[model samples]
Target: MLPDTLDITAIRADFPILSREVNGHPFVYLDSGATSQKPRQVLDAERAFVENFTSAVHRGAHTVAGEATELFEDARARIARFVGVGADEIVWTSNATEGINLIAYGMSNASLGRGGQAAERFRLGAGDEIVVTEAEHHANLVPWQELAARTGATLRVIGLEDDGRLRLDEAAAIIGPRTKVVAFAHVSNVLGTVNPVSSLVDLAHAAGALVVLDACQSAPHLALNLGALDVDFAVFSGHKMLGPTGVGVLYGRAELLNALPPFLTGGSMITTVTLTETEYLPAPARFEAGTQRVSQAIGLAAAVDYLDAVGLGAIEAHEEALGGRLLDGLGAIPGVRVLGPTHGAERVGLASFVVDGIHSHDVGQFLDDRGIAVRVGHHCAQPVHRRFGVTATTRISTYLYNTADEVDAAVQAVADSRAFFGVDR
Candidate 1:
């Protein structure tokens, strides 16, 4: 249950854009899976940083530089606390996509003999296996595929069950001694199914394979304890979590980050530079190449503060309530087919469904006409959509500011869409 301390009306008031009207109709924004709307507090945080301390972090010996650097590192500590990790365990990146790619390419570098003896554990050969699930976003899938192609390692996938959940039963069979890594989504963005991260972590660890979590969907909605999760690495985007764009996080076990080779090099990330060779700094700094996203980092820290203030438990209960209502309401609508777990299964606050005899584009447009914004397409998990025998789906995703009434409104729009497109059964 949402705690009394959290005033829903006040929380909604913090988001200035919630009052927006689309197509002259009351706007019902449901594309939070793509990017969450920022509250005024987050916006103010960024604005304050830019207005007061607009200087490059860790670059100069000026007063503003020191201020900027302090703010930047402070943000890191806050984010670290939010995710249950140490400051050094978190690496800053442009987004979670880059975070996953960093690991893949670093492993690629390791295979090509880059980080010396320390990186050998990351090395994979033709006989080695890289396990992923069909539910992975393209960001998670493509990088590993590229790594496999680069090193001659085979890319193996855990197929989806008919209910759109990962077939973890195959883990014991497929993830064997030769498996070097197992990467999977913590929560399905399209299907809304929250995957079993702990069990998957155990399975991967038992096989001596590193567990990588794509926590894009879970990090914002769920309480994430990456340390307790015992995963080798995890990545999530700031934009998806009521934070800024162009900033994301990569969390790794400290020792693994020490062992793993750095992906991007040069500038602030380096400890020493010579004409012939360069020595890189430790984990967080080494991964943060070039100028860092300082103000955005501050904004993200503010977002962390916002979520923390609301309490993750309350947020989860709120989302679960909304998700349950969405599933129930959408399931009852004629000609609607929800793509994930439908009955008595816990899921995140997103729902993807297809209308019978209608193109997903038409469905999206119909909803748009009603001032309802939804994501329509494979949603970067084409393999999962393929598993569902769907080329596309209309997705309605929720965030902390969303309400049960909003869910009902979105459902009504979806139901009316079938009639508008002449796809009603």
Candidate 2:
């Protein structure tokens, strides 16, 4: 199975916050699906860059500037390798939301005849459709909605099975002749269900549509290979993977990225500029406008290194076991309905559920009283909730540093909540 279990004690020690107490009890963080806790190494990496090599990248000719630029590019290369892609494929953004918007706006610009003949493939118009799934986060869904509104393109949705999995049989029918772009989550953030990426990719490809993968939920825990998946574009945030906020990644195939029109226009992205016209640089630089997130990029690189040293294979296996525990425990509780796939189905170490006769916020407060932190809301995936016929859900999401004890404690807290709230079996 896994190449020896991870050293849980040593891993917990890496996160200094784990030593702290909350509400007179030891803190148990299970909200990693929203954002993960950063380790000391990641914090130190960002601090080191800001303290020592702080300078404008690709702008100044000074020694510090050169060094800063070198480190920045080196970070890109390292992150690229971690995801099984080239440095040229990774474009840094404020977050995964921005990355998706960049591509959407870029396509909108192309539809307006911005990039000339090379960009014709990106153009969309009436009769063309953009497909997204019911499980997509608002970040992914809303952008495509805006794109459709802008380009006169129809927005199509692939319905989900009652179990929260994509309906592939219906998907084949939806991804047809007029489908220009097919976008779906690699793993649903709310349900914690891993989508069938290859099957969806095949359907989209057969229809001659571009594929965009929202990898925010998958990138942090799984070993990802965007090249192997053959998606034209993919995006993930660093904060969800033990790195700092304000930095995310957008991966696009080199050729398609070079051909797409730039979403933001300004310095560092252009090669030449006259009063009348300007020519932009290639791939990443073309998309990255204004001041870059230098220190944050350095921090994310450190996170990549940390994940690699621990082994993604081991991390995946660990999360799988934790997910199974979450499913079984939460399902056994009275009036608790666990969302997404049931036990024995593949899922990440995450579970979202609603308590009958109790509001999600009440459930969250009950758990917080016990020093157990969890997410309580629609989790930015309202469509998924709508599919499940609920307004809100309380979610527990684990990461590599989490232990089985924390999960059991959270489950017990949830079970006790119904009793505290006077909700009977």
Candidate 3:
């Protein structure tokens, strides 16, 4: 039931991998929540750069270097605009994990008096608390844990409800004056539940704490405006959003980024080098140390351009329909328990579920035999699985290119798996 505005056939054609078969059956990729398939446009973009304008950005003073720098910065500007931010606010990292690590390490360095007086706001003492949620991916959770360990700051978690939504009531109580930072996911990778960003932002800001959003899941599926969201910082990966791997984005307010000390410092980020101390550059450059992800950044720009051409609004609408189908079909199966919101609640086009008497690995293998690819296990958010009283679950995540038939096929396969495992009863 895709919307009239979206053409599933034409869109699927853009991704070459979708046309391939597995186990002599039409390949049905339902693991977009883990990583999305790349389109030819993005591939071509990266290839075009590597073949022609491959050069060190902002280092060499030659024609190729100048063009490469322009293209790299232009990619930043385009990606920044895609998420409703200025070019200066975007900092490139290896991946979303690295982006979060950059912020954590930067804050840790600031606490250690690295950035001096300008970084005072980011400094945390022993009594200060860093709050995250039970729904956070390990990428978001582990860094804060390390940051807390390094700074002697306590790490707190906002719990989840029975249906996997964040406990906002508990959040309000937990995010008190002692909270220095509140980090959470925009969308839960396991549950596909969209968290209350505005409400959380209000709570964090009210307590005079900085907010960091993990936008890895939301950036690919929803229409995003980081500036309008008002979170102090955010991070997303290119690979999750139809772009190449080896490149990710960290968006911070210009003033905050400027004030924050550099996490990784070396060549391309320094102003002047003395025998004793080295002066650093400004916001984006200060954070992007070493050689840049020149071609990958260009590919990411092309990814955003493809998304723009197709329209995020239409994509959201299409996924909503697919989500309903998944919820309805999967929920109707015997011995199957779908996690997250119940039938009518809003969520992205993804579901993580456990089948009674069936191991998640078995279920995943069962689905794979039928040419359906899905994500299994804890999905890197162990606490969410622990919250649901399960150690593992199978997940199917959808995107713009997925269609009603693919979701239906996946649903049927799950039901078939229960019978295969002698758990149909």
List the candidates' TM-scores in order.
Answer: 0.98, 0.99, 0.99
Tens digit per residue, CA lDDT, model 3, 53-150: 99999989999999999999999999999999999999999899999999999999999999889999999989999999998999999999999999
Worst 10 residues of 2 by lDDT: 1-10
> What number of backbone clashes does candidate 1 have, counting pairs of residues 3 or more apart or in separate chains?
0
Off by over 4 Å in 3: none
Q: Residues 170-259, candidate 2, lDDT per residue (tens digit)? A: 998899989999999999988888999999999999999999999999999999999999999999999999999999999999999999
Alpha-carbon error at 207 in model 2, in Å? 1.2
* Span of ten consecutive residues with least summed lDDT in model 3: 338-347
Model 2 ranges off by over 4 Å: 1-4
Q: What tens-digit string does per-residue lDDT give for candidate 1 at 175-208?
A: 8899999999899988899998888888889999
Q: Model 3's lDDT to the true fold?
A: 0.94
Q: TM-score of model 2 relative to the true fold?
A: 0.99
